[model samples]
Target: MALKYVEEYRDGTLARDLVKKIHSVSKKKLRLMEVCGTHTTSIFRHGIRSVLPKGITLLSGPGCPVCVTAQKDIDAFVAFARVKNVIVTTFGDLMKVPGSSSSLTKEKACGADVRIVYSVFDAVNIARENKDKEVVFCGVGFETTIPTIAAGILMGIEGKLDNFSIYSANKLTPPALAALMETDGVQIDGFILPGHVSVITGTDAYRGTFEKYDIPSVIAGFEPIDILQAILLLIQQNEAGKPALENAYPRAVSHAGNVKAKQIMNQVFEVCNASWRGIGQIPSSGMELKKEYQRFDAAIKFAMDMPDVPEPKGCACGQILMGLKTPEECVLYKKKCTPMNPVGPCMVSSEGSCAAFYRYS
Candidate 1:
């Protein structure tokens, strides 16, 4: 048999059948927001848009982690990299994302001691060994990755590593979705929700995106058939006039999510107001390391003074994140910005809007 959601979900015949069904049932023009970065990548990678009905419009939201990271956050990360005897640690995606003046990659090339790690735990290990230098993890992620950071914090606490700290840019998904729904630039009939984030945060987290806005949400998987099936589910909901959450990826997600991981996150992080790259400060959407984890807070340890972040000149990343424009609409998209040298994080992250647009179509 096929490997559950993996092989079974990618079935070409199933995808074709579902797409045909979507076309047959969907008579009116509908705007659906795929509120996950992976969905954006998959839509492009699979050429799903090519065969889609002209009435159905898929809008990419503020889902990509690196793209949503504000300019001030980048400045804060690079500021840490510039300090003497400080070992800056981050995931690979953060290295190329541009700050106001520079990026972590440029600092690394200049021998600024930037190290890439698989997880936050790897950063803690560096702090244990490199006693002479302070190790700061340039942590960036959404709900799916926050639990990993929480796990690392637990490890750090158990080991009592004094030298280790994390500069977390962690965020929740729903509030940003709510923010988008409130804005005039976006209007959607349904949402193809993210699968991975649902594993930790669960189906309950998406209820607000539906109940308040009256939009149907289908928590979708990465594969071709899975996405198509979710669209069908949305069409069914739209016809019935019911805006509800249906977990299409039932294998990994549940109504209640991972309780143990949520506990770990609750212990270390508290919700706080935070800014996004294109979007301004969204109230109580971001997580800050709590009072109990003060010793591990790199923002306090470094005393970084990053100014209020500014948008890049003529960059449509903000508009793109708000669903007002696509990457193709940006003047600087391919002219001044590219994968290698991105003026904005949308070009920097592989999951980023511009990168996905350029790569797939």
Candidate 2:
């Protein structure tokens, strides 16, 4: 029964029907951006583009946390790794992301205690085990992961774990969508919003952006059918001249979202201006620990202030994220950048647009 249920969304007959519907209704040259890294990987992995009408173009947005993380934050992580008696914990995707001078992987190879943790809890555990050393978790994620990080901080408080801290590079989704609308030369007809993010933030979270831009927007899952259905909805809205914010993945997302998760996240972190890797700073797009929770802020605890540094000269990750350019348009994409050795974070991260293009395009 479980297998059947999972396969239902992947059924070839259903997918073909949706693809035909998309082709039938898609008249205008629509540019829809999927604002999730998982969606980008899923689109390529399922060959969704191959089946879509040439009139509809899918653009990858700055959805990957690692890909969107600012260069200064990456440098800060590298700085943390270099500190004495410090255990720098992070997700595996960030290991290869090139900082200004060094990366966590390089620091680890040179005897720095940089550990890859599956979750913030694992970093907490490391702090629990090594009470004498400072364990700093590299907090990089969206709404889906922030609550867990907040819970991890609570756990640390209960256990009296003073050595645990997190350098938050966490980003919010809605502000980014607004910023995209304001960006010059970014022509997006509709948005295939992130399902995972919507699950936490709910449909209401996008209400402001939707009302302001009046763009056709649909929250979609990563499955082939889910993506195809979202594309069809956007195309239908575009063709009918009625732009609406619809939730295509109603099974997992709600209008109010997970209230408890948002409450917990708010309890620990507050909204602040945040910088993106390619794009500059977007107001109120970042989450920082609250005043009461300042003790757990790694940046404050360690005085690790990294200066703003320009990205690699030829890297166009910022442009790619903004839909202004594609990975192929970047001069360093395949020539000097690959998964093994990346010139930009877009190539290093698994959900990065360049990595997706390299693997499946």
Per-residue lDDT for 63-109 in model 1, tens only?
89889998999999999999999999999988999999999999999
TM-score of 1: 0.96
Clashing pairs in 1: none
Candidate closest to the true structure, highest lDDT = 2
Candidate 1 stretches greater than 4 Å from native: 1-4
lDDT of 2 by residue, 30-110 (tens): 899999999999999999999999888899999999999999999999999989999999999999999988999999999
Against the hidden true structure, what lDDT does model 2 obtain?
0.95
Global lDDT of model 1: 0.87
Q: Would you list the C-alpha lDDT of every candidate in the order shown?
A: 0.87, 0.95
| Candidate 2, poorest ten consecutive residues by summed lDDT | 1-10
> Which regions of candidate 2 are displaced past 4 Å?
1-5
How many backbone overlaps does candidate 1 show?
0
Worst 10 residues of 1 by lDDT: 1-10
